[model samples]
Target: QVCPGVTPPTGAVKVTPGHSPQDLALARAHGLPLLSVIADDGTLRPPGGGWLQ
Candidate 1:
């Protein structure tokens, strides 16, 4: 993330929900690049690099 933008690529560690910003603010901050998807069961699925096959 912050590393790749400036230096060599690095792995990202998943942070806990308590550490993450609320869905709305996160979406607004990242805009189109980052998205939030909610499931019918109230599950949150962050954007994935998926396409129709």
Candidate 2:
């Protein structure tokens, strides 16, 4: 599906496997890797780092 106000040939949805259940299911169906970016304390972990916090 195309997003409103988005031009043709450039429409895409970003899947956040760690955050959304739907995205996680999509990722799993597509054999995509699941990455953890948030820690138990709600802090950003490695790879994401403090820059994103």
All models: lDDT?
0.48, 0.83
RMSD of each: 7.2, 2.0
lDDT of 2 by residue, 12-47 (tens): 679998788999999999999887877899788977
Q: For candidate 1, write residues 1-53 as lDDT tens digits.
A: 36546455456444333345775455556562443455566665544323411
Poorest 10 consecutive residues by lDDT, candidate 2? 2-11
Query: Which 10 consecutive residues of model 1 have the lowest summed lDDT?
Result: 44-53
Can you give the lDDT of residue 30 in candidate 1? Answer: 54
